[model samples]
Target: MDTKSLIIDTATKLFQQKGYIGVGLNEILKECNISKGSLYHHFPKGKEELLIACLQNLKQAITIDIEKIFEQYPTTQDAAIAMIEKIIKNLETEGTLTGYTFSSIVSEMALLSDAVRNACGELYQEIESIYFNKLTADGFSEESAYSIALMMTASIEGGIMLCLTQKTSEPLKTISKALPNLLNSNIHLVNA
Candidate 1:
């Protein structure tokens, strides 16, 4: 990778693992082995700029994969199931290379940067919207669909965290067998 991309990639990992405040420009510079001149040549706003770049890149990168996840399944429940699979596959494939998600970013830096907070919220809303639409398309009442959408999103996020922390995709594996349970008509309760 070139110097500019190198800085972004390095910072993305550091920021994900440690948080914006946890990682500093000096550490990034030392790790990249690049002068401040080089760093500023690429990012005039310095670390904040690099972080924004990382978040922007993050927005662009995750959207495509998520859309693909939805496309792989023929129905809403199936799509949710496939999404869980994709999450597991992603964690396994990257092997910690991708590090964390926008969910983690908001947890870390939401109150720190307005820009990061907005990006993280938008990223999550995008995923939720897709699931919401898919659930509606699958014959669910709109209100019930929306609730299920949120529930599944939260469930998947929790599943991912559990797996990431435990260093085992067993949560995904454990949940995989129960996916068919979602297809039942009365399985989900919604206040309507």
Candidate 2:
């Protein structure tokens, strides 16, 4: 990969392992084997700029993955369950959820930086939008789809936190099972 991409990738991994505040630019420079000048050349605003790039990169990558799942599955309920199952599988194999560490960043640095906060918010909205599109396509009203997408996003993020803290996949597994029921109940409510 190119130097800029290398820096972003290394920084993203480090940021995932450690929160935004926990990581320093020097560490990212060392990790990327690039000098301070090179980093600044690529990121004139330094760490915050690099972080925004990382969030944008993650948003694109995750958007593609979610879209693929939604395309492969016939229904939003099936897609939702598959998404949770994929997380469970990743946690089982890797011992942590990768590419989905915005929670840590939000908690660590969001209050301190408007740029970071906005980037994270945009990424979250993108995720929720993907789910909302699928739900609406599957026949949910816009209101119901929006609510379900919000619930799904919150639940998945909360499930990841619980899984990480508890050091087990039980929370996500439980979420996988609960999501279908949640969808079904919502459908019933909408029909009624």
Candidate 3:
């Protein structure tokens, strides 16, 4: 890969493993095997700029995945379970159960630059919006869909954390198994 791509990819892994404040320019350079000049040339504003680029890339990647889920699954329940299953598979394969994008940066958002915080915030809202939009498209009332979507998003995020801490995807798999029941419960409440 090119120097810029290499830097972003390496930095992304380091950031996911170490968080925003934990990672350093030297480590990124060393891991990426690129000179300071090249790093600076690609990221003029340094780590902050690089992080924002990483967030943007993550947003694009998630948007595509979510779009595919919506296309492939005819029902919200199916889509939700599929999403959870994908997360389990990815966490197992990557061996890092931490939520890839904002989950890594969230703890340091208050201390980080506004650009970094905004990038994280926007990415989060985008994902939640995807869930909300999908639920509504599946014929849920706007208010009910909004509430259910929030629950779904929270469940997935929490599942990621549980999987990370437990070092197993069982928490995520349990979530996948429970989603159908969760949806049914919520749908009944909404209808009642």
Candidate 4:
């Protein structure tokens, strides 16, 4: 990777391994093996800027993955479950106690930086939108889809939080199994 990407990758790993408050600039510099001048050259606003960039990078990656899942699955329920299952599998593989990067960053920087807060908010909306669009495409009304999408987003995030705290993917697996039933129930109610 190039210098900027190298810096971003190192910072992202550190931030994910350690929360926003848990990591220090010196650690990032040492990990990246770059000088202060080089770091400042890529991220002038320093850690704050780097944090925002990392959030943006993660958000983009998530959006792409979610969009692909939605595109590949024929129904909202299938897509949602597949997405949740993928998360569970990933969490199982990584076995990290740190939880989701977005959650960690939001907990640490929500009140401190407007850019970070907005980026987080936008990321959430994008995630919710993925579900909203999928549900609507599956023939649910716009209002119903929007409401269900909100709940789905909340449930997935909550599952992630619980899984992280418990250090097990069982919570995610349970959530994943229930999502199909929940979406189907909502679809029936909306259509009925």
- Which numbered prediction scores highest in TM-score against the true structure? 2
Highest lDDT against the true fold, candidate: 2
Over 1-192, each residue of candidate 4 has an lDDT whose tens digit, in order, gives: 899999887888789778889999999999999999999999998999998888888888888988999999999988888888888878888786332446877888899988899989999999999999989899999998999999988888888888888988888788888887888788788879
Residue 94, candidate 1: Cα error in Å is 5.3
Query: Candidate 3 residues 1-192, lDDT tens each?
Result: 788888887887788888888998999989988899999999998888998888887788777887788769988899888877888888889887534435758667646578877887787788778888888777778888888877877787777878887899998898898888877887777678
Worst 10 residues of 4 by lDDT: 93-102
Report the Cα lDDT for candidate 4: 0.86
Q: Show where candidate 1 strays beyond 4 Å.
A: 1-3, 90-100, 175-179, 183-192
Model 2 Cα lDDT, one tens digit per residue, 72-122:
998999998888888888989999887865798889878899988999999
Each model's lDDT: 0.75, 0.90, 0.81, 0.86
Q: What ranges in model 3 sit over 4 Å off?
A: 98-101, 189-192
1 or 3: which has the higher TM-score? 3
Error of 3 at 41 (Å): 1.4
Give TM per candidate: 0.79, 0.97, 0.90, 0.95
- Candidates 1 and 2: which is better by lDDT? 2
Ranking by TM-score: 2, 4, 3, 1
Q: For model 4, what is the alpha-carbon lDDT of residue 63?
A: 89
